[model samples]
Target: MPIYKTIAHNSQTSVKIWKITESYEDLLKPLDLKPKNLTRVLGMKSELHQRGFLSIRHLLREFGYTDQDLFYDGNGKPHLKDGKHISITHSFTFSAVVVSEDFVGIDIEKQRDKIAVIAHKFVDYELDYLNKIAENYVNDLTKIWCVKESLYKMFATNGLSFKEHCLVIPFAKKEESTVAWIDYKDKKFRYNAQFLEFEGFTCAYTLPS
Candidate 1:
């Protein structure tokens, strides 16, 4: 299953997703590369991860860009020479990227019940909100996980515990939008997030205004 989806939010921003299920070699073919050559070039642990990386590079090509067009800042944030913001994420079998004229963040998480057990580790004030729900759903938990992950990616700093510093407003099951905030290093930043369901996985993207 090679799942690919692209969203053109506007002229200045777009997103691409690649869900990998085929052999690594087949996926590489679409990018004009040979397996032997890619193995040497990427040196990734698995062909799957290599293909995911290649997918990102291919996306850049779509925008008339290359790896040289990207670089990490001192804060470990990826930036484009053209000053566009980009976020990258990869799960067990999925990869996604978001590029925009302003700061953006994205996260993807495989749905699992274990997240509920660990919720206390990264969920605090939000617990009260989550408990208000009369019924529990795995999809609901996945949504919260994705939202927190998105916040972590956007903040990208150490010592900001999900339960302690990050908070999400209450939302109903199957809700598509929510407001979240993070207070890190004494600065608070808020964002509006949107969620999408993709093949038993939850993905959330946030844009800081």
Candidate 2:
């Protein structure tokens, strides 16, 4: 489906999303990949996952990057050779990448009631305002998960617990953005979070503040 959306959040950050409707073979034929990436894709068990991986390469192409230009650190955080921070995510049929001069993170998730059952795993302070019985429960849960996941990607540090260390400030369902903070080990960092919903999926991203 090509690039489903592009976000120019500011002069320094941009994000691109791809709806992966192409077959694995269709996606594989058009590109050149580093041998490791080819091996990585071939090692994957699901064609859906393979397509998602390939589609992210295409998303990189949209920004004038190639597989060789991207690499992961020991912690699996992605970085571009040109020194930009990059975050990647793929779920179900959608994949997205965010590149920015400042630290940034992005996540996409399919909305489902299944997330509610596991809310206690990654949710804490957020429960203060969440109404488990309301129609917004699933959407709300998904957004908070995405927010934590995005922060996890940007911070890319181990031992940061979503339930204990992250705090998502109260936000109504219709608002486009909010403030969040990470208070871990006496080092505090804050972020500006933004979100959107479409086709039963919720996407959230965070930029360092």
Candidate 3:
């Protein structure tokens, strides 16, 4: 297994990334996939998506887990059988998983200019501080998108609007940590969002303290 990166977040939380270099057949041969997942993986029309899905199982093995230990809820949020919080994401050539003792979420996105085109769909309150002409505009937008996605996975509440319910605090690229909030129903929630840029990919994960 090609484990690309690992973050030992405070001993209790872990983030593992896998670079998908193995062929689909090569990855499939080693997986301990349940029948449901096996069918699901084989049914995927995109080869990249199939590999990404398989690669997640590889990430699980890195954390001492197997497909049998994972389950998805009605909202399609994944949970570990041992009760540890879990979040998973994959993009293009990479797949990742974040496991933490507290409620957690994670996301990975390829930095692309197209994100700027769709910025208005998910960005609202933070636009006040964004610099559209800056060279980091795409990077900034991508980070914000990842933060909101991470929160969406964490909150796991249906009908939560990314534009209205999720808000990422402003921060420069040099800053590794920032705060995010989710306003839904009658309650508000806060998270310490952490992000990193690597290999042209931006990954963000959220944890509640």
Candidate 4:
């Protein structure tokens, strides 16, 4: 029940983050989950993952939704039974959901120095402004990863490369918002992105621009 933060992005879109501090049993005790989802959670080997999954259901309830109202398509993108857009994400100690009236996506990632080691895999244009020696290098990389990840969730398709297809416009970390583009299959899509940091984690969410 620890909803760490909530962002009313606008009248039609909202973001909710939950800090996972409860045992899996305690988190599951108050809700009813669909059989398949229940099986999915129970089958997870990591207690952390199970708790994250259950805590998401709690978040859905906050948005007036139940587990039964959620489903995924063949693309593995989550959908609401009533036709709202939904995106979900979770890291080691946190989980979040973003629901909107338009195409939307969300992601949460823990800030870690190791992200620097893997930055080459998903970084391209942003490198023009990134300084590897800067004090906030890891923090910036983490935000870029979260933005690209949110783009991936919104454009749930095969063959989209984070480094090659997604581009984030330059912006200072203090700005907390930017524009991102997905150039795939010879077509371009635009989204407005916003992000924040809490407890050493970064959470980013996007909506079609």
Model 2 scores a TM of 0.98
- The lDDT per prediction is 0.75, 0.92, 0.94, 0.94
lDDT per residue for candidate 1 within 1-209, as digits (tens), equals 43378877778778788776656666566664445545554677776667667766666666667766777776676778988889878777788888988778888888877777777677678767665344555677778778888777777777778777887888877678889888777888888887888788888888775
Worst 10 residues of 4 by lDDT: 1-10
**lDDT, candidate 2, residue 126?**
91
RMSD of each: 3.3, 0.7, 0.9, 0.8
Q: What is the TM-score of each candidate against the true structure?
A: 0.83, 0.98, 0.98, 0.98
> What is the per-residue lDDT of model 3 for residues 82-140, given as tens digits with 9 covering 90 to 100?
99999999999989999999999999999999999999999999999999999999999
Per-residue lDDT value at 43 in model 2: 99
* lDDT (Cα, 0-100) at 108 in candidate 2: 96
1-209 per-residue lDDT for model 2 (tens digits): 77999999998899899998898999999889999899989999998889989999999999999999999999999999999989999999999999999999999999999999999999999988999898999999999999999999999889999999988998997998899899999989999999988889999999988
Off by over 4 Å in 2: none
Writing each residue's lDDT as its tens digit, candidate 4 over 66-148 gives 99999999999999999999999999989999999999999999999999999999999999999899899999999999999
Candidate 1 local Cα displacement, residue 41, angstroms: 6.4
